[model samples]
Target: MTAEPRTHRTAPVVAGLLTALVGFTSSYAVVLAGLRAVGASPEQAASGLLVVCLTQALGMLWLTARHRLPLTLAWSTPGAALLAGTGMVDGGWPAAVGAFCLVGALILGTAAWPRLGALIAAIPVPIAQAMLAGVLVSLCLEPVRAFAAHPLLVGPVVLTWLVLLRLAPRWAVPAAFAVALVVLGASAARDGGVTGALLPQLAWTTPELTWASALGIALPLFVVTMASQNVPGVAVMASYGYRVPWRETMVVTGLGTAAGAPAGGHAINLAAITAALAASPDAHPDPRRRWVAAHTAGWAYLVLALLSAALTALVSSGPDGVVETVAGLALLATLGSSLAAAAGPADGRESAVVTFVVAASGVTFLGIGAAFWALAAGLAVRWALSFRRRGTPSADAASGGAERDAEPETDAAAVPDAEPEPQTSTR
Candidate 1:
């Protein structure tokens, strides 16, 4: 009897550790990539990671404990990828930090205004999924490209990931991350003693707002976080039949983002993939007790934050391509799922494809990124098709009232979902 109680006590802690491991393995490299895109140095990037982890972890713990629901929040991995693809700006890191602050304020505004939340909810699922798939394309392809460039270094990482995916899917990413680190360390030791201290260092970057940075970096970051991360995150919770108070969650995440940005962090949002680990029945036999797992995971992230500088140092020691290779390996499963979601159904296929192509092109026009353009193009196509389906203006005018009735369900919260079976990996 005493043994049973001890097992019960230990389960949630174990679940939390698993959740944090998956969360870190899959997304930390992308976070580094994002900070680098804005010209953040290694110390600055480490600080960004530290602040983001601390803030999002606290937000997750607070929300879960308050609601008695496993509400897991995370940094927007897709938003980070968007920043990486956007490249450096005119005012550099300070300008990017300013953009980060603006994005947080925009998220906070959405929480305050029901109409704004409704508008965000009104974006069709296909376009949102397509945009996400598009954003992931470049990074997802890095493993293959990296192997081609550095077969000796990257091949082993990919091979280890593939083998573990077959034999021990849950350990696949963490194992690969470890293997890559070992190889990187060895390579560095061969060249010379690795430089850089492994202690956590906090750095702050003052915001330098610029018109070009705001329009280009800030706008795209906000859109991708909302469309790719937050929307899907809500969907994931709803899939498990959790009617999350999404607006409240948004308010807290926005506040977290605002707090972290000046410390070099980018936007934080809902966790779509890793959220399942704590929300699932697997976390605890009793559904009501699952929040304990999420809360524990939050504490674990806080612990991880203390080691952010060391983690960043390990990543910075490797060749850039090797780091990307590991990151791409970690994201493969997520990319596959996003693509599957994007391609679903017949009606939205055309719009989805257009969105994917434009976003994957990495094109920049008038200081704006392909992600914003892709979203615009997809929405335009969807609207035009809806108009065409309604026929001529007289017909459209005649059926305008009916057309309103024909609109796709815009209430994301109201969409019922069958419980999602837990995947082999949290991602």
Candidate 2:
């Protein structure tokens, strides 16, 4: 039998550009929402956003280049929101940057310590899925509410986009974004207001760091970035068949975090859903050639980061409703899949139930969110059940002493062999 040929295909510049645009656009609202929650002045928030985009782009570039894989680096959207809410209220940009540094150090520390890294890796997939779902559920709901408010505007566009996605999976998001943009522009023009005013703006602020800020802002920012963002980000790469070393990826992310933190870059980590968009077969069936597209994205990010003012102007000037609606829709598929995957198999029903409920409950304790708690609860229940089963004496063992005597030997046999120890010679 003959093996099939492995074809190499390259990602187009336009595709890379589109990927970055979608990535930035989808997360932009979260940035704004976070900034507002934290009480940042419009100027500080805008400057912070610029720093975030630039750092994210650079992190993405360095990792992708090193691994020859499409490893996307992004600012933690959730972390940003956390900082905007907590850090902003407490200390402002200084606190937030301090949080960024702390978080970066923690992530780097995890990478340096193999035991911790292994433990993180050992987290069951289902629990991770549940946490991800819980976080994204609210985000996915926004588009639905937006459509209800303006059916004539958002309804037809969303419906059309869904149909296209079903019929042409690869082109769905880009096409939908295009259609929505046109409709929004036309509507704005008809209303006698220029539609092009919603583009992003460029803003830059020098870094300011303090101890209080670092503890209040930077530490939490780091935790969310590593736990929430990078964990899933690495998963995206694994799903796409790129098995790069975690330590290297962590180091790259750490460097980016350190470089951009002082300038207001909160936390940088791998991309999960968005990176998958560029890494999957949809981007290019050929794995080897896709590196070109990822490289393109990295360079593009660098340009945007350096030219922060222009990029900020472009996004800020665009129609708010259109951008939000489109981003919400784009994330719908990812949100659903993550939730479903987290639920686990039917046989593990009770554990799965606990995982979902706790994660979705939005309960937070001791500065940690529901995601961490859900996994903990589920794991505890699973282990308890397993231990109980193991401890129970079998019915056959109760009937015969001989069978009972054999059990220990069987258990011993089942135990895995340990590696041989090195010998020290005595002269």
What TM-score does structure 1 among the candidates reach?
Answer: 0.87
TM-score of each candidate?
0.87, 0.66
lDDT of 1 at 67: 92
Q: What is every candidate's alpha-carbon RMSD to the true fold?
A: 5.1, 8.9
Best by lDDT: 1
Residue-level lDDT of model 1, residues 140-233, one tens digit each, is 7888888888899887888888899999988887788878888788777776746566887779889987876787788768766876677667
RMSD of 2: 8.9
